[model samples]
Target: MLSSVLRSLQSLTTHNNEHQECATPGSSTARDPRKQVLMSSTTFSGAGPSVGKRLNIDGDIPDPSHQLPALPSNLPPPNATYEHSTPPQIPKYINAYSLFLAGSIEMGAAITWQRHMAQFLHHLPLTICNPRRGHWDPDSRPQPSDANFRTQVEWELEALSNASVICFFFDVNTKSPVTMMELGLWAHSGKVIVCCGEGFWKGGNVKLVCERYGIPCVNDFAELVVEAKRMLKQKGLDAVTDEEIQRDEEWAKGIVARKARKEA
Candidate 1:
């Protein structure tokens, strides 16, 4: 195990060196500052408010309480989307909720349903943990030795841990083996809501697991958003601070009103 970890660290060091050289000043391949810092060193020892304890180069890669507030009717909720390689911290705000998007992302070929879910839930106090790489190459198949691929996996795992809710979708067009594995990991955590389309190759197996675990399972994308939002709102109400409720009393009331009406 130690030997394998050393090898992965070495691989990460080499990848970082290459990235550094290519991103030199005046180079056409230069990346932005955040990207530079994120890929800075194999050690990942950078110190910053957002940067936390070092995750291994192998790239394996929060709580609150309060009365809550009423979400103002007709008011949009505060939200943000943290893409891959970005800092894992959700926006530091009262009543914030985090949702990790897990599911089919077959090299970006699978439907861009993530965007749809983000848009649909944008009106809530939520942060979307989206793992889709903004500049990924579809043809570059991921391998164990690829540091970038490992880093992406690390980010997703970290995001999943930070999430108050995780939404998984199985698109019928692709075989998402990784997503299936993720479901296995989080099925009993009570933080997952799955949407497996009927036409998916593993729909039956997925449904069986959901049933076994008593997970909230839906059959389509729309329902996934609906259920995920419901879970987020419930969590938000429980975790929002007294200050947040006072500051956004109207909005908080709106949230409570909406929930009451739904229950009614």
Candidate 2:
């Protein structure tokens, strides 16, 4: 009778362990899918069934504070601009000639002119030389001895010299002392073009100067861009900039990768 009772107790224990291993279908434990381990029993060696990869609810690793957004499928990878990227190519003038916007800050009137250039002549994006981009201006400009000032001056000088066509804007509200200086420097070169508004403080002087030098002058800003496009047709896409060349390289790489994928 003792042996038979022992067998009955063993059977009941086995059933209890099985019930604990797999939860009931409608139990609270079954509500979360992540809660299910489904691992098998271990041997005496302390080894058990292999564990699967760790679950990633969002499939992205995050920093302590924030997670970066995943890149969208449809967009092309971003291109790195080589504007200031070095080793600087030897500055041989290639198809780099453009409508060099050589002028003073003049309350950022160049921005409005740039938009018009984009709208009217989408293909030809004029090269702009805005010296004030990286630094702030004082009421008094930086001295010629300053290294940064010298670098900007060199860049502007190069732009003015190499440009096939240049369109200058002398805004009414801005006396643009620098703009007037540049006008004299480039006026006789025949590549210079000018736009001085009606109310410009020195409009008469600018117009008279342009007339004397035979530099094309217009009263309207939009006319300046229109004239640039007309001149660009005569002057084909000159040597492209370093940034444009880098973008082309990136595009070529993408094409090659796509072709390789297809072959694979």
Q: Find the candidate with the highest lDDT and give its number.
A: 1
Task: Return the number of clashes found in candidate 2.
Answer: 5
True lDDT of residue 198, candidate 2: 70
> Stretches of candidate 2 above 4 Å error?
1-96, 107-122, 125-141, 236-264
> What Cα-based lDDT does every candidate model obtain?
0.56, 0.46
Please give, for residues 100-192, the per-residue lDDT of candidate 1 as tens digits: 888765434355566656665665556677775444422222454766566666777877888889999876765565677678878889899
After superposing all C-alphas onto the true structure, candidate 1 shows an RMSD in angstroms of 14.5
TM-score (C-alpha, index-matched) for candidate 1:
0.56
Clashing residue pairs, backbone N/CA/C < 3 A, model 2: 94-239, 95-238, 95-239, 96-238, 96-239
Tell me, by TM-score, which candidate is best.
1
lDDT for position 251 in model 1: 41
* lDDT (10s digit) by residue, model 2, range 18-91: 84467876776445322222111000011111124211111111122111112224533222221211001223
Q: What's the TM-score of each model vs. the native?
A: 0.56, 0.49
